[model samples]
Target: MKLKLNAISKSFGPVKANSNINLTVDNGEILGLLGENGAGKTTLMNILTGLYKPDSGTILIDNQLKEFQNPREANKSGVGMVHQHFMLVPVFSVTENIILGTEPTTRFNKIDLKTATDKVVKISSEYKLDVDPNALIEKLPVGIQQRVEIIKILLRNAEILIFDEPTAVLTPQEVTEFFEIIKSLKKTGKAIIFITHKLHEVLEICDRINVLRRGKIVGEAFPTKTNNKKLAELMVGRTVKLRTSRRKMEKGKELLKVNNLSILSDKKEPILTNIDLVLHQNEILGIAGVQGNGQTEFIEALTGLRKASTGKIVYFGKECINITPRKIHALGIRHIPEDRQKQGLIGDFSLIENIILNTYYEKDFSNNLKLNWLNAKKEARRIINQYDVRTNSEDISANKLSGGNQQKLLIGREMSRSINLLIASQPTRGVDVGSIEYIHSQIIKARNKGIGVILNSTELEEIIALSDRIIVFYEGKIIAEFPSNSDPKIIGLAMAGVK
Candidate 1:
């Protein structure tokens, strides 16, 4: 299939999401779509997938102009998209989910469960997806869930597959396997669109790269001919400092101490074991690990969201165990949660409301039982301007902003308060390089101002760039520790459980 998007233009009132954009992808090739958050990547893909109509454009598939009124129509036209968030039912079996909308019917007019199962199993084996046909979705790991999504697209006989931020949730090992699957699919003459903010992955897997900035196609380059720096420059429309510059930290008194920490599963199996750490004021301690290595559990326990069966959690040299998250916040511990949509902000709430979600009860925000909307709006606008959130009004719902802007808002909300320690997990996940640089600078600024920071991220480069000391976690235990100057290759090996 040779797919071409010609002079696409889309407008939502005054905001032009995509403007005069042209792109192409051929069979047996991977086309990388590189852009920052809110750069119109989502708009272009939405138009292609039939979720939105392009104000002016023509979609040519094999030289045939096509118009798809809905996703089903697009699917019938051999277009399938895998979203950043997997669209799967937790209770459904793999076969059931894959054959959900397109079920085979028996002669008796009943759904043919056996035939669907067999087909799903065949596809899984062919692609080396290794998914069990009968496994329930909630029980499967993230990587397997992703495979199920791909299998869903393949079952539709899609010649052009659009993967939107497909790797944002994958582990390194799974990432390696995913690249192999893409290669295999390419060999089978499939056209793939890889859309994401990660620059290195573009170089690693893509044949050609297209960069978008502010709703326009700014540049395009071959992976071999262009590097990450050049791609970032084109995507951001400026020189982006890939690494944040930071001064030497002046470590202060111990702000938090954890000893013999352990997170037990429902069956009482140890998720994290014998963890011990000390976080000092004016210091940044980074926890680096692949996904699902007890990092999430550890952070939850520290923030009082999860309880450890055996551990001593102390803050300010006092026991903080059995405390609520609000109490921990009252004690000057702020958390920037990993999953922003689920944990950080209320989607239905305005940006002003979310900004004051945690601080609405303060004396300045309330007088007796009367809450001050005036003060809340004032503070929200201040944070918005201070954090460079890209939004015109604070009255708009949080769901309307881009992911990077949402992150900036959350970080600003967390850091603007009186905080003694900041626990930030995947702080820059899904954000662009420009926002990342700003966020990293804000973190360093907080650390320099005598606030203890615990930075947990899956990106090794981020850990090495920001942390004063780095700890590698594998299977819930610290396997290795290194200074800020440690070689990334060594840390990578340690993260993979190398001795």
Candidate 2:
């Protein structure tokens, strides 16, 4: 199968998301799509998948023009997308979920789930996916759940597959396995488009690379001929710094300490058990783990977003156990939450409003009677200028900004305040390389200024690059600790719950 998108142009009001973009993918080819946030990669993909219509464009499959009215139509034409976040239902079995919309019916018009399960098993075996047809999604590992998604598309006879950040949540071992799966798919004569923010993965897996900058196809390069620096430069349209530069410094006095911290879920089951750790001024305490191994719960407990069943949280010599989030903020503790859109900002709120979302009650922005709009707008503008949060006006809604810009705004708001400690979780998860560089520099800058930082991320490389010390979280416990320069293999094993 061969797919082609020609003269694709899309506009949302004044923003030109894609302008005359042209691309192609053939059978047995894996094409990597590289772009910065807001560079129209998503828009272009949406057009191809029938989620959106381009203002001007043509889609050709096997040299024949095709127009799809919806995602189902696109799927029928052999185009399928495996989203960054899996679209499977947690309570449903793999076969049930796969055959949801297109279930075969028996003579009595009842759903022929038995037939679907058999087909799923066959597809799984053919692709080496190794998924269980009867297994519930919630019981499966993330990597296995991903296989179910692949099996779903293959069962529909999809010839072209789009994987969006497929490895973002996978552990190191799972990533290796995923790469092998991609290679197998390529060998089976499937045209693949792999979109990811990780430059190294693209260079390793892609046959050819096309970079998008400001809604335009800037350049194309083969993985064998180009490097990360060149690709990053092309995506951002500038000379980009791929790594942060930091000077060595001694770790200062203890700024925050956790003692036997334990958190319980709503059902009274333990989520974090007897967690003890320390953070010192002028240091970045990196937390490494897979997505759900108590990292998010631990961060929530620290930020006072979740209650701890037992333990002490000491901040600057004050025992702040069970403190309110406001009190935590008052103690000069800042948090950049994991899910930016949900916890960091209010989508309908203006940029100026979001800048003061947590600080609106402060004296500078409020006087107990009315909000100081002038002061709030001034602070918002300052953050926009300082953080390079690309937006036209402070009056625009927070959701109007791109993912990277939204993150920068959140960081600027938190760091701008008088803070002693910063708790940043997944700080650069979905950001582009240029923004990652900037955010990393900011974290190191905070550390250099004698501020303690608890850096929690799923990206091991980020943790290794910026941390002074590292701790591995596994099934609600800190299994191991290591110096910043410790071997990643050992840490990775610890993350997978190895002793």
**Candidate 2: pairs in clash:** none
**lDDT on C-alpha atoms for all candidate structures:** 0.90, 0.90
The per-residue C-alpha lDDT of model 2 at residue 488 equals 84
Candidate 2 lDDT by residue in tens digits, 1-499: 9999999999877889899999999999999999987787777887898999889989999999989899999999999888765788989999999998999999999999989989998988887889889999988988999988888888888899998878766767789989999899999899999988899999999999999988999999999999998899889888987767778889999999999999988889889999999899999999999878899889998999988999999998889998899999998999999878779999899999999999999999999999999999999999999987867789989877766678888888988879899999988877889889888998999999999999999888899999999999999999999987778899888888888
Instruction: Summarize candidate 1's per-residue lDDT along 256-312 as a digit string, tens digits.
Output: 999988889988988999999999988899999988889999999999999889889
TM-score of every candidate relative to the true structure: 0.96, 0.90
Q: Pick the candidate with the highest lDDT.
A: 1
Q: How displaced is residue 337 in candidate 2, in Å?
A: 2.4
- Please report how far candidate 1 places residue 374 from its true position, in Å: 2.6
Clashes of 2: 0
lDDT of candidate model 2 versus the reference = 0.90
Error of 1 at 99 (Å): 2.5
